[model samples]
Target: MRERVDKLKEEVCTLFTPSKDMLRRMYLVDEIVHLGIDHLFEKEIETALKDIHESEFASSNLYEVALRFRLLRERGFWVSPDVFQKFKGDDGNFLNELADDPRGLLSLYNAAHLFIHGELELEETISFARNHLESMIRDSVVKGPLADQVKRALRLPLPRTLKRVEMLHYMFEYDQDNGHNPVLLELAKMDFNLLQQVHLKELKEISSAILDDTYDVYAFSSIDECRTLNAAIQGWDDTAISLVPEYLRKFYEIMLSTFREFEDQMPSNKRYLVAFNKAEAAEWPHRNYKPSFSEQVALATETTGVRSLAAGVMLGMSDAATTREAFEWAVTSTDAIISCAKIGRFMNDISGYKVTVDVAIAKINELMEDEWKTTNRARIDNQAVIPVTQRLINLTMAIPLFYGYDSDGFTFGEQLREILENLYVKPMPI
Candidate 1:
């Protein structure tokens, strides 16, 4: 395996074009880098890229210039954005003529995302290039590979998308064209297969440990397995019957189904999962750029933890009653479930000191207000919502007095597990 990879690496290096063909060479280098197999050929790529950048790089066309600038800046080269100065008109904007070139526009679309917050030209370029590229996609004016590439870029631009996800999507999208090097394509396939095996093995070990440990408590069937475990943990806390024999059986079944879902996601880049998960365009873009505290809480209700609680509620009651109460909880805001979900989300941001103990004291005080004895209890206990909601508002809004910014997530998760245990299972002895 190692020998073939070494051979393929050398073959890819040999494909690099020099001097006048430097622009062409950079295109291949960009693909190789984004594919994340560049570590194998890093020294060769660096040497070739530097040579191209130093030798007559400024004389290249718009596509070449944009691609070269993007690749160099991304690789930590100190090239100036002034390289784009030549492309501008007397009006001090990018030339109107440049919008006609799809390849150049695409390169600029990618380059714009690398802006460091204050680069005004780059910011303008993002809006300009996106408009042209998206118009092309919307109008069906372009076809074949370029059109497909446009659509893909619109969804996951180079800078913002996760590297592994990009490599996974591009792995299958990479086709050996008549002029392209087959050796590079073959190397990519081999490396992806190797990486995928590692991902699967790691996930399998995690899946096994989860089933072994949580089989006695609760298991979740309908969501991401990691989140399912979280949901099941909530179920164990939220209900006295979480340990009942029948519930445990359902828990195992749910756990098994969750693992199966993970396996299903194992084979492809998550385009399948994403398709099902994505809300329509009208419903997305989330109404607020930074979601408010209540909005975040409402969003958390859609998560597995909240739905997991709902599942237990529905399981113990008839459909008609469950639906009515669940709707009431959703509309009127069930303070207990809302607080629990908020704690779960914020636990990802918890510190061992303040957020940790604050959560404990607050939860204890909350349980004292109303005995969370039944699913319907929290829904109708209108008084419980005001105090819990107010406390939550204070905690989030007043966090700045201590941290001076939004919350910082820790390397550890759920620091108040004992507090949750007291609230959910049964109260620990004072």
Candidate 2:
């Protein structure tokens, strides 16, 4: 599998005119990312994007300018919104003629959303592009991949939708078009479904464990406030903003309640994770004034949602003592816990931190392997525990996202329950 992946990646990198053809390379970067296979060619993708940013678009076409700005800013690179200046008229709005071009309008619409705190031009561009694109959808005589892409992106903007989910969506569109690369499309389909089943399997276990243990109802009241919590983090205001400090305080209270559960199962000294709670408690809001990538992930992991789930894992498993020790391993900021928390931060991006789940799970598997060698447990029980815990860490961060974001695949709470039962409990009729 690794060899096949490497060969495919080499072929993919060769397909790009990385240095000279800025537009084509950028488009390839976007497609590769959307296909959910960019991790296989991270350096190549990063280099291409960086070169495009430095060369900075050979064309002044709206799609070129918009795509360049959107891609760069979305990835956390420093790019100026002033680059959109040339696209505007003397009257200080996006060129009136550009509105007639559906593709350009769509590109601008996407670029507008990447604006952080305050950028008046990008803010205005969003309104202008949205109106034009909506009209394109309503009018007659124009319909194809270009128009369809606009419609889907309008319906579910880039920032809000998950990358993997979006890629799955794009695959359907790609399948219909003769323009898409056939070999790459076949490879992408294989990679996507393989990962999809892995995610579904983990999600099934997560939903089942949530049901068996009865943790769903407890988090319901906090859902609304947590949603507001996410909103405020984005610089948006809500009445629930008042609940921010209180909600943060109450988070530790929940952690303490879960920690108390470890008393019966864990050693007396290990039962109190005062330092863990204290370390997390100090960073109430994960993103501070000028937050870095590393800083944000560190703070996110400390959220009551992630930490509480670590506590719940101890209670959920059959071997209480071993689970408690594993929980302790997680709470102490082990590689497993930190990596898992980092991924949780991007739960919204769908493409964000998702790659990390496989990384974090791999680390936990390593830890489990080390323990397997040291302990004298029965082979059957030890094997069972590793897979279960691997899935647990994979989905732990995801569970917190239900309140703030929607899942394209699972859709609703009842749908989640049904999926778990169908995928794991009942067999498909052959």
Candidate 3:
């Protein structure tokens, strides 16, 4: 019997290792119904149970194995009532007891069964798993081989506790079908250090990729589109505006169309109604400009303004006058930077010595020096715009050599590249 059990264990391990494809296939509903029923007829339930017990199963893969066993029983494979009673009872209180058990492996397996079989609702399944996982994590029993198994079963990175928290947050925030406040509360208790590190690492990789691909496009097109539209509206050069790039022109047209659709869906007296009406007229000058263009531009401007103001407030720059000035400056500066990039001119045209490219560079340098001090400084939650503003400021400072302002003879692109290297590319000390 011992020799047979060892052989069976080896087979099961071999079947499951390196990948789960074979296990998933064998445990699927149709396969279980067919083979499990035949196995019951050929080998008694006691023999099967003995096989499982002697396997010395790894806890992580136990969930998958237990699920297979449950399917077998459900498919009319006979098992004594006593075996069923060991895990569940007539009252359904067995799950709660199992959840509280010091040995969480079995509980996790049972929870997986309830989850996969839809015996419990999605929220209930997630909650049960989270609670049990948290208990195991807090008990600190989830280490060594057990931890490896848990990580494998959960299909997440190690330090299972933090993964649980992030999963809970994702479920609560985005999984409309499984949102549960209690699970969120439980998640909040986890160590945020691990979570933040993981999140920031992911964001850094994504941001780097985006910057690499979109920096030139975003910088150039945003200016060209806005300037063409602005110039057309101001009646500066109708023929030049007509020469706008087809793709960008189409984007403006689509923006106008979508804005109109959105406005049409709104109720009367909504604040957006006023902007929508104005935007409709703004689109007329472009070949494809429609009445809705004004509405879309208005909407975009308002959204940008609100975000900028919120960012200012979050940064503790909430003085109403200062915040308003900063937001206005951000909008104008953003437009100007884009315009210059499109015209292929740098800071040569920008006025005001105090706020010039040189001053911006000095500010970035000062901020870099005091980056440590700003570690605990006020932060804006609207991360997208804050960094964009920082980049805009930096780019503004780096490009457009002032006429007598050093005349170092470095081309605009070269200067901008140097600035990006210094401000963004260099790795910060960890």
Candidate 4:
């Protein structure tokens, strides 16, 4: 039974040997540090080090060499806490001397470690990262202890890629502030190329996240921030904007569509209605009300109503009024009728006439022809007089075509057709 247990243990160890070898070769000690394994299994690390030194495969010197290299590359120092009783020595200037050498690789490595480990905040780290990045960009070579360290840091997921992109964008803004337009342009090109390689979906999500974070900032931020964003978007290609999520595009379209609908429903003379019912029914609250003859005459006099009527005629509502003069007259007459109805409603409130149809008609006509002599002759003839007379005649002729309702002078069919024809026009083909 003991032999079987030993065999099982040996098989498990062999199975994990390849992974352990890879971890050692990759110098994944930093990864283990990030995982907090040092604190969790301190004894295990010590036992491993002891075994490495004892084994023929690894000499005592080999363990010390490996430890020295890791410390030099990652920590920017070769002092082993076990061996160095006092790394600083009696002279505090030793550390200062280490940093003074321009060609010193240890100094660069130390600076990078300080920057990546959050020993420096955003502002400080940005400067540090920028210096190292600039050095690489200018010379394409990193020398000294810091060279391999900085290169490895860049390859590692130390600073998130998205945050790095944001930092670059911020640098462009800084360049703009300093009037360094050429550098700003180069930075923009670099950022664009980097962003283009990112997955389209990821780019959209990241942009949206950025927008959301800046929403309130843009709304209340200095005008410069808003201007900068606008400029950035303008500088970008339309293809980049096209990559925005479809749902957001749809949202903008719906808003524009709503604006157009309100514009259509509003009376031209009045300030457009601020509120409109969106219900899609053709009855009651949603239904358009047809004005009576008196109401029509009143509308023609209201400035906004008159303008709206003119627009309606231009839209081809008047079949008989082909000429421009006739069309203008038709619109003016329609405006006057609407005005008359409004006035009638007002008078009813004041004098309490009960506003019967006959009384309303008389009021409308009285207002229409009251200044007949002073009216523009050509305008009155083509617009007001002719259009009204023709419309009335058309209604009279259509009486036989319609059935039911003979209480009024005009038949129901004639009245209904006149109202329907005025309010609705067939949609134009796309």
Candidates sorted by TM-score, best first: 2, 1, 3, 4
Steric clash pairs (candidate 1): 237-424
The positional error of residue 357 in candidate 2, measured at the CA in angstroms, is 40
Q: What's each prediction's TM-score?
A: 0.48, 0.55, 0.24, 0.20
The digit string of per-residue lDDT tens for model 1 on 1-430 reads 6678778877886776454677677878887876668767766776776787677765647777888877765554545667788889888888888878888888878766655433667767878889988887778777776777677677545543445445554654566245555677778767666655655566556532233213222222222333343444434333523443453455555554554543332334422221222221113333434556556445544342343332233333334344443434433335545544454444333332345476665763343222212221232233223223222222322222222212332322242343223223331111
Candidate 2: residue 300 Cα off by (Å): 14
Candidate 2 lDDT tens digits, 203-237: 75642211111112223444454444433333322
The residue ranges of model 2 lying beyond 4 angstroms of the native Cα positions read 1-6, 16-18, 140-142, 200-430
As for lDDT, the candidate ahead, 2 or 3, is 2
After superposing candidate 3, which stretches have Cα over 4 Å from the reference? 1-66, 69-86, 95-122, 148-430
Best candidate (score: TM-score): 2
Q: After the best TM-score superposition of candidate 2, give how far the Cα of residue 353 lies from its true spot, in angstroms.
A: 30
Tens-digit lDDT string for candidate 4 (152-233)? 3443212211222223223334343444333223433433343334444454553211232132233243334433433333
Instruction: Quote model 3's TM-score.
Output: 0.24
Task: Provide backbone clash counts, one per model.
Answer: 1, 1, 7, 24
- Give the 10-residue window scoring lowest on summed lDDT in candidate 3: 372-381
lDDT of 3 at 83: 33
Q: By TM-score, how accurate is candidate 4? A: 0.20
Candidate with top lDDT is: 2
What stretches of model 4 exceed 4 Å from their correct place? 1-86, 92-210, 213-430
